[model samples]
Target chain A: MYDLRELTEAVRTFNRDRDWEQFHDAKSLLLALVGEVGEVAELLQWQPAATVREDVKAGRLHTRLAEELADVLLYLVMLADETGVDLGPAAAVKLAATAQRYPASKFRGQAPERQ
Target chain B: MYDLRELTEAVRTFNRDRDWEQFHDAKSLLLALVGEVGEVAELLQWQPAATVREDVKAGRLHTRLAEELADVLLYLVMLADETGVDLGPAAAVKLAATAQRYPASKFRGQAPERQ
Candidate 1:
């Protein structure tokens, strides 16, 4: 498995080599992240929910979805790096908190009212 | 220093234990990801770009942004798992392709027209 640090280093090198760091302020990175996310949402927008897994697996949506998802991840790494957040640890902490907040014993087979 | 596989496994166990896999079809996960992204965007929306780093560092936006970003990541992981795509490898490949597409020597200091 590729490490998140490797990805962050790759992004850091890419931006540094291209002199692009000046353009990647927090807001700009956030906007770019949002744009990539929009692309992902757009690709998945009109598809029938039941067919989504098959469509993605059959290569119909796989390539594009993978690319868009990659963009999202890269921008996310960049944003986190800029803001001094370590994603892996942050995510771990969040997941633990979420587990406590919605324990399986309580939430099992139950959808949130909002969901 | 946390591993992506660790995060994926945690998500898997959480959903499995909650029997929430039934609710995590690809489209629903994508929509949830988008919604979380929107929350992140909304949190950053009116803030001046210049102070984003400080705001995030000083705890004003840190806690909320971290939670929203983590939700985005968890939903993204769920979506990819449902679709049989491994995010770490996919991102590594995409980053490589992007590096080739925009070589630093050629694109240095030149912003893409669209950006």
Candidate 2:
């Protein structure tokens, strides 16, 4: 139920309940994003990789991730929203551009950095 | 000159040199993305906050970030590229979507997680 669509609805509810439409200004949203990321780091503080990855799958790390992700998406949505970008379609657009650059022949099999 | 466009050109050049298309299957691209992320983490391995921030502004942390970002973009571009989507336009699309959800009223003044 917590998939992307469900989560989006929650965002709408949160928005309606709190009447927070005025404050999610771009700058603020980005700052909030930094804060959520900090929280994510807090979860990993002093923990080993094993613990952190486990936290992700276990849904323990960002107990707030759903909300935080919403926040991030909020920013994304807003940026897309304000700029008239279509959220879902934009991803498709960017990919088309990449096809020209990577050309399939150059990007395959390369390690992360080298490619 | 090392802004997004320049970096993109580098990707093209690298592609031409390696002829790696067959290998960079989606799976490999993602694996490479993860590895690039690891490289960023390694730079911060045991480093203090002061050091990490400095790297970001001073361009040290992901000396590979540009490349890594490109790799991420490569994936993004391909996804967009393949789906008949345009990269630049897609961002605009996503932004328009955010505008409705955040609406600026519900998201302000909230600390990172609270919002």
lDDT of each: 0.84, 0.41
Off by over 4 Å in 1: none
Distance (Å) between predicted and true CA of B31, model 1?
Answer: 1.1
Best by DockQ: 1
Worst 10 residues of 1 chain A by lDDT: A1-10
Clashes of 2: 51
lDDT of 2 by residue, B3-115 (tens): 22333344455554556544443334334534533543443456554343344434443334333333333443332222223334333343345556555565554432445
Please name the candidate that would achieve the greatest lDDT relative to the true structure. 1
DockQ-derived CAPRI band for the predicted complex in model 2:
incorrect
Superposed on all Cα atoms, the candidates' RMSDs to the truth, in angstroms, are 1.6, 11.9
Model 2 lDDT per residue over A1-115, tens place: 2122333454555554556655654334434534543543453456553343344434443334333333334443442332233434333344445557555565565543454
Q: Assess each model's interface with DockQ, reporting 2 decimals per model.
A: 0.72, 0.06
